[model samples]
Target: MTMDSPIPLAIVGVGKIARDQHLPSISRTPAFALRAAVSRNAEVDGVQNFTDIEACLAARPDVKAVALCLPPEPRFAAAITALEAGCHVLLEKPPGATLGETDVLADLAREKGVTIFATWHSRFAPAVQPAKAFLADRAIRKVTITWREDVRRWHPGQGWVWEPAGFGVFDPGINALSILTEILPDEALLRAARLEVPENAATPIGVTMTMGIAGGGYEIDADFDWRQEGPQTWEIAAETDGGLMSLTGGGKTMAVDGKVVSDEPEAEYDGIYKRFADLIEAGESDMDMRPLRLVADACLLGRRVAVEPFHE
Candidate 1:
């Protein structure tokens, strides 16, 4: 699409993520023009706003694509509707509530002959590409990821996070998994997992998992907790043949052999829009479900433990 004649795009779900990331990125990138938005309680400045996805799609038939930034539990149906309407779909991270749902959407996209991008913005971080390239020829022996932050500080009164179908700690943890899956040398499976749920919540507040890689035999231990105090920590460190490769500050900084290599201002959503533009141009889908798959597997097989009740 030419710069003047951008692809008409609509956003389903005008939540916090939609406003903070999707709108800004779409505005900055020339690939897409925000045509409409669907939400129950919000509206964009100049774009058409609807209370439902069907109405949005029906009203803007010219919208060739849609971005679903709502919660994962309600994402599948909207995505299916968009794809069946002959519009490409861009899904926010964690794809769906379950791995099965994402698989279903993927199949539906194929049947409809439209693209479905399961976007993991963290994977598009500036350092991730270089880090993946740096480890192209190395053997990774171990990996450790520690993602701890205060939920009240970041999510403040988001009750859905504590629901049964909602992923809770896995919400942020999945970002780490997305980065790990992208940078790892081989597919990995969770060998063990322990989830600590607050007494009053349906979802866990903390989780610890151990993952095993294929033939090369690499182990990854991850800890995700929402009870951290003071400064937050989001880091992934891997021990490989090329010394130690660590991604600090949530993939914004990269270090190898105790020496800082690449550090840049965060622009994950910008990169995501750029990639979406490229995918639209190439007429291809860029959906990867491995990270979500791992999360599902962990939930399916993990042992649950009760903890103190959490209060917002």
Candidate 2:
């Protein structure tokens, strides 16, 4: 709340997601000044650093907001601490270990009179809005999402992704679901799902889910895998009575009827930061639990199959 200064903000969890996206987004957002980093494994240049969120809050009273990019399990507590300290919060997606926890955090934020922005970054992908517009009121068809990437190349040595709370392939799968829900004409419900869990890992390395669009019997399928070897793919396509609608390149590209409609460089995190700033300024909260709810429902309906042990 320092006049003439950007809103002081602290970031918790300095992982790859933070370093590659959140940090740069914050640096470019004129509404925010990166004031502190709370992470034992990472540090930010010229910013105060702490091993944990409590210490960061204790040291930076001027910081009015916190952006948490930690694993979903720890994020619940970190968000609670920030809310208790009178700080607005921005939460990276899949906000908590369970849908119930996310609901609790939203209630707490309201009770505390603080805003919470539970970010679903993929919803900001440049082509998503265009795709949404294209599908509005003109849908009676099927949707398929294929999201695949090599965990070895992207996650590298990250073993936590295999932990129960890590959410395995859903870590990236949720991104697809986010975009799907953003563009689709109606709410989605998971009808059935199959998870391919590695014997050595607690979570699935791959998943296939069948979802039902509200008000229709359209088939919606999403396949996500962490074992893809080459040419990482992130694409979603729908067949409608009008034509084919597709979003490729993690929603950076949009096409209709096999013709490109929208294509642009992605600034998902930047868009998220801008939205967070706007919500904070307006004294409002923007929370969406749809994407995560679908994931939770998928988990509840999924059949788990044990695969061979995996190793990096």
Candidate 3:
């Protein structure tokens, strides 16, 4: 493709997130042209569909970029294939099943001179950068996160969420961590954690964590649960020397000192694709592993408490 033309792109995985977020964002972003898709059981109309990534890549050599929307467990191999074929890659949140695998992908991308973006969609939320600006000059004293949502309403019949490496409640909790890592002036390190795992599941359904700022003067406490039956809650509040800044509605709204400062509609995926286009143009990669590292630390240093089994 020419520099003035939109980048030819392919999307792998046509699941709910791909349908809801990625496809729509790509449609609106003029920098990318959807050329193909790869999915075992799903297809997008008006686009060439393949049953596998290799077939898609081989058939569409002109497609210079790919977005992987599959689960983290299976993303590494696809990312490797895309990068090896000299294609820019945009990975969904949490990048891969492990930090090491993401690192390998990053190295391969660098070697191949292609861009690989391990995106945290929450960081692209409208209110996040505003909150980051608000906290940039203040001394944060404490942070509290409450991210509780009903899995049945959001995930529906997705049983892989309870499997090992699926990340359970942390699937949502990492969003908060991503925001924290973006906005905080200092690195946040995990101190201790408690994980409430379902008796029959391999992942935790509930978690409580304590983290300390690397610069030493503040602490963060977070509670995550996947069993809220009614109205869901996704909020993060930080008490700084300036005032209390609150980010609610999953970073769609922000309030400081109990006053609403920023409120806007969700456009995270759009922002993500915009950034990806920019990265491809600049020949750079954006992959922040802090959020995933915190999750790994939580699992490593946490105390597991087996709770009642969860059923769909």
Candidate 4:
């Protein structure tokens, strides 16, 4: 992998995200060249496509890098195979089925001397970096996250999202935490939570939680729901000593004291790919698990209420 040559790359999982974001981002990034795709149901034009990760790796030995967009259940396994094959791996957010799995993958990557990027696309929203800068010197009093969406609109027929380890509402909610954690000056610790789980689903359809910020008494109120109809909301606002700072449009827009500061069209996946290239070139890995840990903590400490069954 020389500085001049584009690194040969493969993408595992040709689902919605692959078509919607990953492929476009890869096409735009000169640091990588799409060499193959691994998916049973999808194929890339003018590129070698395989049915599975194993097949992809076997067929495309020239590919030294891979982006995994698989579900959490099999994410660790695919990552393990890629690492074992000496490829720099990029994992989609929430990393794996459990915190422990992500930890193990990190250790394995370290041992193998391969870079593993557990990418949080939401954190790459244009305003996030600026928000982080703005809040670095300010004192925050409270943080509130409002994330709501209709599952049917976004997920469509994605039934696995309601299963165990699917994280239900936390699937989208983790993006909020990722952005919040990225911009906040202090770390977050789960205080308590209440989740509303549908009768037929193993995960929650709604959640409300309180978190404590490190080194300060800043309280964080997180609200996530998948049952929201009509207008969807993804906003995080905080009251600070300087003023009120908010990141709306899921970190794409930043406002200070009710005035819009930064509002830009999102290119989150592009940022993600650029970061991945930077890490690969520098022989480093960026795998932050704080957001996932928060979700896990919520599940550990949360009280679940049975709700009406959620039908697709």
Q: Pick the candidate with the highest lDDT.
A: 3
Error of 4 at 132 (Å): 1.0
List the global CA lDDT of all models: 0.89, 0.90, 0.94, 0.92
lDDT tens per residue, model 4, 9-48: 9999999998999999999999999999998888889899
Comparison by lDDT, 3 against 4, better one = 3
Q: After superposition, how far is residue 12 of candidate 2 from its true place, in Å?
A: 0.8
On residues 1-312, what C-alpha lDDT tens digit does candidate 1 reach at each position?
Answer: 334578899988887888888899999988889999899989988988899999988878899999998887888889988988999899998788887788888888888877788999999787898788887789887899999999998788789889976899999999999999898768888998999999999999999999997654888999999999999999999898879999988899999987999998899999988888788777678778888888888888999999999999
Worst 10 residues of 3 by lDDT: 1-10
Candidate 2: regions farther than 4 A off: 1-4
Q: Order the candidates by lDDT, highest first — what do you get?
A: 3, 4, 2, 1
CA RMSD per model (angstroms):
1.5, 1.5, 1.1, 1.1
Between candidates 2 and 3, the lDDT winner: 3
Cα deviation at 179, candidate 4, in Å, is 0.9
List clashing residue pairs in candidate 3.
none
Count of steric clashes across candidates, in order: 0, 0, 0, 0
TM-score preference between candidates 1 and 2, better one: 2
